[model samples]
Target chain A: MAAQTLLLKGVTKIFNKGTQDEKRALDGIDLAVAEGDFITIIGSNGAGKSTLLNVIAGTYAPDEGQIAVGNQDVTKSPDYSMAHHIARVFQNPTMGTAGGMSIEENLCLAELRGKRRGLSWGVTRARRRRYREVLKVLDLGLEDRLKQAVSLLSGGQRQSLTLLMATLSLPKLLLLDEHTAALDPRTAEKVSHLTNTIVSQNKLTTLMVTHNMNQALCHGNRMIMLHQGRIQMDVQAEEKQKLTVSELIDKFGETLKDETLLSCEPAGAP
Target chain B: MVILSVLPITLQQGLAYALVALGIALTFRVLAFPDLTVDGSFPLGGAVAARLIVEGVDPSLAVAAAVLAGFLAGCLTGVLNTRLKINSLLAGILMMTILYSVNLRIMGRANIQLLFRPTIFTFMENMEVVRYVPVIIFFFIVTVIAKALTDVFLHTEYGMALRATGDNETMIRALGVNTDNATVFGLGMSNALVALSGALVAQDQGFSDVGMGIGMIVAGLASIIIGEAMIKPRTVFRLTLAAVIGSIIYRFIISMGLRLGLAPTDLKMATGFMVILALGIPALKGAREGKIHLRGV
Candidate 1:
């Protein structure tokens, strides 16, 4: 598989522009993710971590600057237009898969993602067997429940399935926006571990947004803290590995204080 | 004696309406799209078919044309919602209202009578079967074909994508399906079936009135609810079948109500009440359990 890189240059997004509610959700941000890079992004409320992921996923076009996935410039692309190369798992487990659809059916939808869906059957016997094989890896006993509706699955199982689905076709970039946040702690950990397994197995380039300080410090090879619509800190390799929870918390607290100061500006202020 | 005669007529009416119920299930259940266009598209089908049939067009060709007309009407509704950014319910209402005028133009009048014209049902009249039995049989065949076709279609890749589009638009969009197209296609297909039902019903009743489709949406919903109540719709085939069976049972219930001294004009009111009761039951049960069932994809 040929590796792919993602590049963002001077990306800016202002929600409710030119209004009293106008907020600079993202401002002049530049980010370059190399091939096989897994980056964790941490931010306090409204810090634009989710916005950054959304912009990259083509959910929102950047008001200024360019976004390139692999060699393709997709700055103005719609969400579905970029989905072939970009897979996403939202914070809600229910957002990742169709609840009313069966397990095998959901997997089939994922497997055929970005591919032309023609007159062929969605879930064939062959594909069902393949899905069973794949579900076994989740260790949630979902293999035997291939025909069951996904709604019947627990949150952890659903999130695990979502993680699996996101990486099923090996997207060029996987965007996870606090995918495990809605689950119980134990389930979250299980999904987190499954995420690590899937990402490494596929050698996928991933951008995960999280609120957990310890999780941000522990999971990815690189970490970035966002405050006031900008990257407050970007830690890599050895710097990220040696970062302790308290140290990360201190940095987060320091930036959060600055964010409050930034938000206190008078009306109509830039 | 009246009950014996009413049984076959009611069966024909019920079976014909099975198509409408199935179409409603497609949008409301499969796509989770609350489309009001069915109300207009139903009569639109009858208007188109009645006009063409009266113009010396082949009955089959007229029916096909009616289906096509309905499909386009549904597509317009979907476009209004997906492209024009109208709320879905409002989009459907807009289409339904516009179709009222369009249906009038199709027939160039408020209603068209097919009494002297040969329709698809005319073939069954020449058979040895009893008058009502032949009509019932004809409708039975049509409903089954529709149900079977839909069952097979739902298992296909495009059908699955359509279902997913309704189940979760955000996820399907992320998965690379153009949900706007899906919405358009789904709504169009849904309305086509409804129009087909209207065409069939108009031919059977010997007249196509612009007001024929009034309250049809609620009637379809009632059929679906009644069908589901009788049998759990766990599979695509089952759901489609349930819609048909529900339509038949709904007819029986209406017939029973009429026999019980309810006026014909009270039918719509009864149907509306039935739907409200069916929809409210689950919510009421959930409330009793101290929970509210919030519905959405």
Candidate 2:
């Protein structure tokens, strides 16, 4: 399995437990992500893509089974404590970085992630030079505006910056949940390109959940189609590379029909 | 001549209140939480400091105790919000309500008179100090230290996470930053600074009244808004300086109002009006700009 980087074994999560309107967000799901595996997840609105990512990121506690990052059991670890090893990029660009703080200050914040935070000088000249060098790699001219507020940046620029911030310390896992969904089409394309570049350069083990089918198939080394809180189809690098959008659509249709047929068949038909 | 004589005293008092305002700014502006616990915690500090001093504790030790007590009161509010899962505003109100009784209990009454009792001020009083020199120096030293500490803390890795919690709690938690802990710890530090201000105010005024904290948060807000209005600094150091300047201007306006036949009893209303003006002005300007656009359209 190329040495698993993240593992989820028979994991389940129930929101509002014991309540009449309780939701089974995840139902005994099993997932294993190997090192350098960039997996794209896709599903309908109510499907458990986000919920699964939240569970792995330690934002939500699973009701059963176990989750591990590498060899460490992080099933019960709290969010901030896990920040040292795991980084996440949100859908909203504004949510990833502090708006009022300058780009350098935000970069400084990302650089200090997972370390003992102390009261000290922020954004020294040397640090600013280093940040400029890092930003230059984006080819977006962000290096020239190091002192500018991050809020001034465009959506694509902010997302690109967020990607840099998230990977600054090179975390063990990177979670992207519809990160470019909120951006305009052009900006989304730019951010997606940036995402591909950064992920490949860093060799980051990534889980990217996207709504666009083409995007799901086009990027990442692997793809997983999720439905009814479980993995419906898993495709590896070689198979995924050759998988067409029409093929994915066909598989999705097949899965949907199978689910409908099983539901109609019986109450306990295994 | 009278104004000149009192200028230094007013400036000193204004600076001291700026620390309190900074504390308020942390919760209200930075964290975006309406923490009513400032009202109770402020007097709670005075009560703790005055009571400790009366029992012959060193002035510095008494002030430290007061800060610690304020921290606990703030943490109490956080506990109410996080553990009890209460609404943040109500959690602050509940803590404030409880703190009134706690302050009274600590003081053994409605007030603690520290007059003639040896205090930190006493040491300065005997050192050939000018009428306002000791207090101003004390205020300057404390404000600088507090401002520096705030700047450094906000810049740290954990501090950025704290700021991130306020910016977007859900995303921050998903990034593996504990939003709950950040909120609690931030609130604790905020109220501690406020209580420290209360302790210093008690020493300066020679008495700590249980009701002294009423309208304190409003006053603090006014200072912060006014400071931002005057010198809009993007850096943390400049932000703190703006807060201090805003406080001084606020006090100066209040004193000017008093001189212009404004009643002392109407001070709270005046403060409210000032805050409204500070908050409303920017909005009004933006609205005017919008109107201009509509006319052009």
Candidate 3:
């Protein structure tokens, strides 16, 4: 529907290269995501889901391949250098936001991300009022407690704030690395809803890695099942909606040698 | 009479060393860096100021040069850590050791005496006040300016980035902040204040000795502990105020100990013990009261 915002060509990453324990975390892979493409990624553990996201976010450089964001060849860029165009939220709530800083301060810092930080006052009165307005979307009453340190927040609230922070600068690509995995089921559901809202509202090109099969099938316009560092299954909107949990499991069972992956229950299912 | 005699000395020492305490707090608390470079930079400042002033440089300009030298020295430590891939603590130690020889070279000896020179103290001596009053007032004004500048800087956008660099480097780096630059700047600012402190102290005491900065880190920590104990440091301004106030109180305590006949040679040991007691009490209490929960056990 739109121009390609993100592209990966023949990307491969091997951890501990040239060692006895050298493991190929990602194999030759090619992917392209268009503007406003919210793609969900699913795989068993060690299936290169996180590795793929990491390579895209510039946390781990690919052994061979090229990554382009917004038509800019960023294959050689450092993590901080790529941060101008890419925003990422880690799985750990604490990893996403600074615990020592206040909510408003955190948001203010996020606002200046990817921009030249100057000697100007960080949280001006105008910025604080704007933060209050932006935080009202969370409906967590975080606007009322802008001065409270993020450490004082509950896990779900922090994740929400982190998600807010990541999108504050309107990054070209957003990477969510199992961002809801650490939250409780109810909270996870809420965060998932918020994630969907933020992604669609901004029309952001997002790649969300999740272990939940149900979520992979339910959330995004497209679902890619990564198995053994390869795209095993790629399903589009109508086909993805028609796919069920049982069918997805059967498909995984056919190609994967590991039976341990079948035991991963979806959220809220005891 | 005894209190009057000790009061001016206590106040002067407290105010002067408040600069060092503030420097220590910046690296230790703000950046989470255990910078030992201040030890070398402190005396390095005094040596530079004392040497320059003795050679007919304006006392104020000499002090400025001392700050610049200290900033460069701190930046060297930061470069060693960030660019050279050395651990921050070891880099500071390396810088501190190297600065010893540099200080010696600058003064051409182990010490310099400015007994009859026109120093910052002499400039302030023209004021119509009691003998020690002007010096104390000068130190007060300088410390306040330094403290206020720190508070204002920490609120700036670049300052927030620096604070975040200390708070969560990974997160800030991911947000596109050049943390290496922030670290370097933070270390530089920290040591500049420490050097300023040393320059003023040397001028006030009329001498600069290579050994003056020995045991200084411990004294600074002790002052911080005393200040934190007296006033809870919630905000940036309060945190700095605590350090300055703590330095003053620590000086008073040392004076009291000396009045009670504690040997001057045992002063360092006494300060070490006070820090241990101050730091250990809360940790021991936490261990006694904090409950550990295990689910599967």
Q: What are the per-model C-alpha RMSD values against the true structure?
A: 5.0, 6.1, 3.7
Clashing pairs in 2: A79-B176, A80-B176
lDDT of each: 0.87, 0.82, 0.87
Candidates in descending TM-score order? 3, 1, 2
Tens-place lDDT per residue, model 3, B175-285, is 999898889999999999999998888988999999888888889988987887777666678779999999999999899889879999999999999977766765677
TM-score of each: 0.94, 0.89, 0.95
Instruction: Name model 1 segments beyond 4 Å from true.
Output: A1-4, A257-270, B1-5, B281-297
Which candidate would rank higher by DockQ, 2 or 3?
Answer: 3
What's chain A's TM-score in each predicted model? Answer: 0.92, 0.91, 0.95
- Those runs of model 3 whose alpha carbons end farther than 4 Å from true positions after fitting are A254-270, B1-5, B283-297
**Error in Å for residue B11 of model 3:** 1.6
What fnat does each of the candidate structures reach?
Answer: 0.83, 0.48, 0.79
Docking class of 1: medium
Error of 2 at B162 (Å): 2.8
What TM-score is obtained by chain A of candidate 3?
Answer: 0.95
